[model samples]
Target: MGAAQETRTFVVWDYLVFAGMLLSSAAIGLYYACRRTGPQTQKDFLMGGQKMTAVPVALSLTSSFMSAITILGIPTEIYRFGAIFTMYGFSYVIMVVVTSEVFLPVFYKLGITSTYEYLELRFNRFIRLCGTFLFILQTILYIGVVIYAPALALNQATGFNLWGTIIATGVICTFYSSMGGFKAVVWIHVFQVGIKIAGFLSVIIQGTVVQGGITNILNDSYHGGRLNFWDFNPNPLQRYTFWTIIIGGSITWLTIYGINPAQVQRYNACKNRFQAKLSLYINLIGCWAILTFTTLCGLVLYSRYHDCDPWTAKKISAPDQLMPYLVMDILQDFPGLPGLFVACVYSATLSTVSASVNALAAVTISDIVRPYCPSLSEKTLYWLCKVTSWLFGAICIGMAAVASLMGALLQMVLTIFGVIGGPLLGLFSLGILVPFANSVGAFVGLTTGFAIALWVGIGAQLYPPLPERSLALSLNTDGCNLTSFHLKGNWTTTKGTFSPNAFQDHSAERTALMDNWYSLSFLYFSTVGMLVTIFVGIIVSLLTGGRKQSIDGRFLLTKEDFLSNFDYFKKENHISNQQLDMIEDGEAKTSELSQPITLSTQSV
Candidate 1:
């Protein structure tokens, strides 16, 4: 093990390449900071003065949530399970269609800073607060996972200190995010996506070459059962069936692309509605490209290790480290290539962490702080936003310590998103899609849905499905030379074996219904939570006298509106010219009435 690890150690050129990536990122932040002319307003700091273009915003949107999870976890998932995970590309298509047609128009018309502000406009402040709190919790948890993922990869590959990598990532991300705000984050995303793509391409190109050809890789995967994609099983308990991947995957991406503040803020930052819609469409293509790259990486990994299973052979500690291990194994002879891949992983981490930090700052100021301290000055709020970014960075770094204990990077991230994001998605959907949903129903439904989803998610984590239930593809270590390898004492390769005693013998105490509920696949967590929230919300609303007050048409998107042309700025079938005029007048009034809190020099 020591000799094999020594072969992959980072040399001088490798360190130079890695350092160059970090310095370039920090320099971008500094460049943006130097461009600031005076005390920045919330619009400038948080919204990029609403002058962002389509392509950059689209790239930023892609990189924001894709993060280290997609870079590392998706490939790992594909390797462990099969290519059925590639069905997620279809979900991205569904997500973009729904987001562009339904959610974007309402949000663009309303011109809100924080996505949760729409909750207050449509429901009440309490619901808005609930939505805000859920977003904060979800983002912080997700960012922790993102920060920890590449740290684990680097630690496994090059023996970098795990906590040290986490701290370095958090500090660098915080520096740019707090200093330059939204503009810096978006521009850095554009930069990082290039590096990420390069890194992924390197792995695929080299792996394919090493395997003789793409056809050979495909043939190996097909024979090894890693080319699976045709499972049409309707069982929700099945981890990666066709039904779960499409339906469950759609809802999962919807929560992120549709209503999540981190995403919505990018749309809101666009120059106009056209640019915003264009960005989402462009993001769809970018997402598909990324999914394809990562999925191919998995197939390549499978092809390379078809005979000598790394995990079974004890070449790596965890599945997430597979990509890094492959990179080190194949690219060691190429100077600076390993460091470039490391930069690629950290680049993903930076884009995601910076975006989350900026979004967290935006929401804190718009949803939490501004509501209570409406009198705070713009200059004060600007500095406050910076401080909040730094604070959240620290909190997320601390949360990274806890994320290490979570089972797998991909599953844990999706679980966090489903448990928290599903109900939040439902809350937003109830307000926009269901016109009659009242504040009472919205609050009750969100809370209840969250509680139940958390319970099921936790239960699923605690009592995982049996080995046979997951139906993992077979692996073999027959080709491995066991004599030269020094295996860890605790590592055991138990294949195709199950003991009734593996789990506590509580079958008699647990009912079948309870067992099925707890054993449901993680993919369906979002669908279950979303359906529960919408169903319960509607029922509760009707029971308590639904929609007593007349709601602004702007807050609601009817079926006709959803089907109509996407031109929202003009008078259309959905919103009349009079209503459009009212919206414009309201915007003007809001601008005129808005005032920054001020004090006399003496008071200061």
Candidate 2:
């Protein structure tokens, strides 16, 4: 038997108990899907009858916000930077205040199903389609990451194959989400998040109480250098800095809460404008709480195993696996504790999966399928939403299995999301702020923004790293070892390592330029990408000039967007077709001879 199997840390009882809990929750999800009735229209299917309460909605938001990333990625940030990651946690408050004040009201008033629909209203159809497509793509990529991390943990714990775990998780999620629709997803999310929080918090409390109180954790952390603060370097290459956090993080926050389709679906779920905004803040608060436990747990784990060589653990081939690896070591004496922690990882992952399934279904149905088939019935829409959810789930599973060949899962996911999502933010901003930005200018701005972002994202990868640093620090091997992947001896078998002979092959080999330039610098991926996007977009917008007619102040309800909602504004006034017509309304004469579209006389 494999050493993982031989170790058998979890007893039969533990397996049975955990299985029961998971199955029961799954049963609840199935029930919700089976019983779901009434309106399955775009509003209800995507938004949850538009009567969802603030609390569950908030919880659901938090649940979606956290994925395998929150559980595994943050600790890594702490492990890499010590206490500096605290900056990331506190950044949430800033995200909430700014997001609540600037963007919510416009979204609420516009009655948008997909956030990018506003881009179409503000910009041209190409930008709208571009923004919507990227949102879907980014969300799918993130969902794949969410699935991959948990599957990795389970693979290590149960001696299961990693690919098998990925497929299993994807299939199970698809079954429920495909059948249950949004109702199934939200209910499951509520429960899954609740379990995740309880399990994570309990683990933290136990680790703290057992390890001589929270002070010990802090003291250990301080000595270990996890509490690092203030990287005052003005270099743009640095990854974390006050400026980057405020600017880039704020942009990310805006993309998520202000314009991302995932949160939009949640807002659309609420019955009232107040409830929708209520849920937004409530979610911010919940994320605040999640950060607390996850951070504490991270410190505790690090303090306990500060002396351990994480890289040496055969199971710790990836930095993200350290949490689960530590959980195994931490619970060596307590039979069920490992199970509990594993359960927590599963819960967080599942909540994320359910939420993604829900969001993707909404986007696929409302943005893609609905536009094509306006005559489809509610029941038909319901089935289509469910089917699309399953389709997306399958895509995510396939991507998760292939993620191994990509860049670091964490950095790759964020960079892709940032590059694509950054333009969407510009689109939303233009929609609400630039009254004179006709579809032409909007389109020009959007194309320029995206082209700029694309250049930074793709071009940056091709750019040679610091040529000087390549000579200073480099590692090369003539051959591979059977350590990280192959388990030659047993679970107890020592992990594989680079043989000393490998370096003999090329001690003089030049290092990659990335190693030279990639450090705690401000010139990171997001930094370069954001600057390119905003700069190009603004310039393009200016050069293209303005439009006729003043946009209504009511439509640009910056702060009021969220504080109030479009739901109470009456159905007829939902879209400003008449108001929009007032500007281009008279362009009939100009467009009469120019029916061919080209940033001129758009949709008159």
Candidate 3:
């Protein structure tokens, strides 16, 4: 009991270290997320004026991917499950390809202010709202989980109160998000990404040195039955086979690259079609490199501490805490390592939290509010953003608590997002792929893809894994498998020999199978969603007599139904500029000119 408690304990300095870093991050992020700038229009908040350079974009990719759960949860995966989980790094290939071929071109072409507007343009208002609602809801879950993970880590390590951690993090994130908007979010993303990778790579090297050498670590992992790389089994239930990789891998990439809120927000930030493509291409290398680096840490953990026996030690009830625990285990001898790790995790959270709040602010203000409150002013919109950011922050913290109590971290992550993301992707795909599919047909296809994904995802979760599988999938829902080495403590850690499990024990429960054939791969989820949407959309169009929207080539905007709204900002700008010019020139202005009023500023 004493040893177990000691293993999970923390120091006062650890608490202070974590708190100080977080406070600094919040201050910096707030400074960036909400700073006042030129025009202060809705487009600036929603898409950062589509003028972001590759540096911030690259960091944004890093920050978005390496959240608390990802930082800690992924290493835990490698510790318990072996090589299958490491395959996640390869997903960048799919991301780059899909972003290039499918999503970026359309989003850049449309110039959409609300990514969801395409849903309305392609399908109808219901599907558009549904898609937007799901994006917001799932993003909340994602942010919440991302928020909860580092807090959980700190709580376990230093005995900081969990609720305190939650609220503290939430309040600070809200402060920055309410102030800086997208520009702040993007700059902080750059900072967070740099710190996170430096911290991550440092541990990979240190952990390797601490556990004997890299060679010893490799030997232990290989000898412990964790080094196998192939699962040639043909069964669909075999979670990590080559076929699952091809089919499921494709789907995972599609949702993230094509439709997920995090990626879409970034995609819409590109200044041009080529830049969007270039950013994704840059993101691909970074994605693959970061994932591979993190995955290697997993392998290294498997090699060195195979003796510690994470499950038997009961350091955590689930695999999510493995990485944090592993860090603490090593940090027992080293000062500042844990602090650095915590800082890195916080960095990852910063990227996601700020991005999420900004995205929600944009969507709520642009899609839902703009449609209704057509007369909203910039001053009113900014205040609305403050209120909206605070509200979303509260909701996300609650969702994070729920995620902490439920299934495997990965499973919880996917289940919360999968049922809806596919359809959202499809709806967007329909607008781009099928020019003739009108609003009504798009709406139908969106619903159909969602329903199909839900049914399929549920089924995959409940299905059992075959005895020996091949490849690890990118799909959600606790995808990894753990095979314990020390059943009754028979295997000698010194000699590195192990006994096999009894094959006759077929009656015993073997695997935790959940429904949702992991479409975590890059192409499958979006591809299927797209195929279903295009097919259903065309059919619905034929049935309902829908037609191509008539607009001139010059009026065609990638992200917005800009033909109408283009006239609005342009017209308003012309009038406002003319009015300002006359006032500066000391000439009498016409009665038609609206007054130039100062925008009120409030500190959150």
Which model scores highest in TM-score?
Answer: 1
Clashes of each: 0, 25, 57
* lDDT tens digits by residue: candidate 2, 1-604: 1222324345665566456546756787689766765565656666665556678878878887877677776765566556555565556777676665567656655556666655655555566677767778788777776777666655655554667667767777777767665666777778778667766876677778777898998997888766665555455545566655656666666667777777777765665555666777888778878777767877887676565534444434655666766665555466666666666776677777777777777777766676667689888987787778878888888777555443444455566666777766776666676555555555655566666666655543434334232111111221113212322123333222111111122334434533343322222444444445555555655666654455645546543344433322423244344533432322222112112111221441
- TM-scores, all candidates, are 0.90, 0.81, 0.78
Q: For candidate 3, lDDT tens digit of each residue in 1-604?
A: 2121233345566556666667776777566554555566655665675677555676676677667767776666566556665555455576567666666544544466567765554445666677788788768867877777667655554455767877777777777766676666777777677778777877888888887787887787777666655655555545455555555555555666676656777856754444555667777777776777777788776765565555445434345555666677676556566777777877677667777877787787766886678688976876787688888878887887665544455544555455566676666666666566676787788778777766655444443223343233221212122322211211123111111111124454543432225323222444455567668978997688766455222222333323332233235446465555553343422223422211111210
For candidate 2, give the lDDT of residue 341. 66
What C-alpha lDDT does candidate 1 achieve relative to the native structure? 0.82
Worst 10 residues of 1 by lDDT: 494-503
RMSD to true structure for each model, in Å: 5.7, 8.7, 9.5
Q: 2 or 3, which is superior by TM-score?
A: 2
Q: Candidate 1 regions off by >4 Å?
A: 1-6, 482-514, 558-567, 572-604
Q: What's the lDDT for residue 51 in model 1?
A: 76
User: Higher-lDDT candidate among 1 and 2?
Assistant: 1
